[model samples]
Target: MTACVTVLIIGAGCRGKHYSCFAVHFPSRMKVVGVADPHTFARNNLQKIHNIDKKNVFNDWKAATERERFADAVVIATPDRLHKAPAIAFANKGYHILLEKPMAVTPEDCKEIASACKANNVMLAVCHVLRYYPASLKIKELLDAGAIGDICHIQHLEPIGFWHFAHSFVRGNWRNEAETTFSLLAKSCHDIDLINFWMGDKRCLKVSSFGSLSHFTNSHKPKGAASRCLDCSVEQTCPYSAKKIYLKLAEKVVNMEFEGGATAAFTMMAFTERLGTRKTTVYGTKGELFCDGSGPVEVFDFCTREKTVHPTNKSTVIPSQLMGHDGADYYLMDSFISAVAENKPSLIQTGPEATLQTHLLVFEAEKSRKENRVVFVETRKEHFP
Candidate 1:
């Protein structure tokens, strides 16, 4: 094992806490040395978990990254729009970064973040966590060995479930593109990134897409329907009731929801409520690969006229404890910590630069949808102003 790596976490929200849970799981391998979050409860929990000094705990990332590099690396899990300043500062300050996806909200900010990381010689890894799933890893192995032969095209779907979409994209933090980012980048950058990764650096030439908030907007709201679920007369039959997830009292959350500054109760409840599905189909000359993230991956061989199924991407043992994302989340955090310890940027497949193209591909797809025209992906040199 490499030497233990210390990570300071910014933004103790949903994702920040999810990745930092690794520190709690493997004390000998890694630790959370400092945390900066405006939420007092979150900051307090991080301190308790890692025995962090009050001096090392702050309310803002500006304060966290203000001085001598306190830890070997930083985990910038701040929201999509707020990534640039902290990312640029910490990179220039010579701290390795594990930044969340949609590296920045705009083309200019994305380019600037990558340039800053490169110029400072800092390792800036993006949170394209889907690549770390054992199932995904197995798929990569199969493709590399010609299990699927030459690739033709790929089809992917992210069924942002009826209620899940209503809760998040329609009425929650990511309701519109202006505040957070396009739903494509904010939500499904992982799918786009993985498609690019599996294609082996062959640039996405062009893509066209079409989607809309067809069912979730005010236009679809039933007549006399109360805006708040609890107050609505048709709450039981509305199909989009908060009661389905939250249950009974709208304000009452799950037990131990925020105990010990950990969000186990909240995480479990939220994920359990999420009925979303992600599926990917990669077409190849010899065969085709199909996978439903909620289930197994199957390969169909045209020559042999047979099918092979992998329950967990051919993994010898599907880890049972990690319990979320098919254990990809745990593996991703572990690999990043290991890479930071060894000072090797190649410890994982996804990095800041590679993900930039994937992010751009999403932007192009969005353009295609809005303008109703095919958008060609520009080469790497052609990206940004």
Candidate 2:
């Protein structure tokens, strides 16, 4: 019989909810022994949803770790800035870790987390959920099969449409470049990782990026505009109004539902009410992918004149779904559980080799930006054991 892995969840936000749901789906082998978050509402929601007892709830992860907690592993879903401490604490205590994306806000911090996990023999995995997408996996398989030959270059973009950017970045937690790194680091780290995954042995060489608050800045505000979206003068005329986009989509996206983060709904609505739009583009040698709204994965192959569309599991054809990144939420969790149970390497994200490669791109990209030159990615020979 597979030994059930007891798990501790930190951060009760959207990502936390996804992890909890994943635990529910894998009850035979994984258990949600406890959850931690500063927000009472979020903690209560997780407890009720996962049927966890009040004693298992914690506002501080340090305290949770102190009691020789029930968890065999810790999932760090806290804000980007708070990742390091909990990750180090849990890893030092010999608890395996599942971290949210970008690893840590800075490369130095990523190194620390990685080193601690390695020294403690704790498995560390990052939440780069895009890799779990079946379509994404297909792309990787095709590349390995030499369908596109050697990858020479890649140009990727995340078109966080006018309102979406405003909600998440401008008015939301990731707005200021100072608060989050560049829009690229904060958002495009996934693209960079995918680019590395697709490009194979090729290095980034250099990255010359140019972007700004553009449409969302105070300088771009229209005449008689108010700070809040609910009372904006453009509310009636603007198609980007918060109420129009978020409230409308909330009827569909589960995480946006009233119980989830209705605050995210209102916050998104407010940003859309203010900033007009935002977009990103990524180009690679083999093919291209694009996303405007928070929807499905769409792929277009220039060389073969082929196109594939993979709808997120949220559509009518697949109404009921998991949190995190659609089916990706389950794919990653399942991989983690299997890796732990079998005492084998994970095929999905995590693992030192994969984490090292992913973080190297971030490091090189920053170097390319600062040095005003293209930085070549160094090749590493280690394979997952």
Scored by lDDT, the top model is 1
- Tell me the TM-score of each prediction against the true structure: 0.88, 0.77
Question: How do the residues 1-385 of candidate 1 rate in per-residue lDDT, one tens digit apiece?
Answer: 6788988999887788778878777888788888999999988987887798889898988976668898888999998999999999999889899998879888788889988888998888888888887667767777777888877666665555566765786678988778888776777777777666776646566566665555566787888889788788878887668876467421111111111121111111122333535666777789989887745779999999999987764344334434456567777777788888888889866777787777777777777778877776677788733
Which 10-residue span in candidate 1 carries the lowest summed lDDT?
A: 250-259
| Residue pairs of candidate 1 with colliding backbone atoms | none
Model 1, runs deviating above 4 Å: 248-274, 294-296, 310-322
Give per-model CA RMSD.
9.0, 9.1
lDDT tens digits, residue span 1-385, model 2: 8788888899999887777676676678888878899999999888887888788899888888787646788889998888889998999898888888778877678778878888888898787766665545655565576544444333333334566665676667886767666555666566556555655544333333322344555686777877766899887676557777678740000011111111110011222232212122233457655444344455667787897665544322221346345456667777887777667655546565576666656655556555655444444543112
Alpha-carbon local distance difference test for all models: 0.74, 0.63
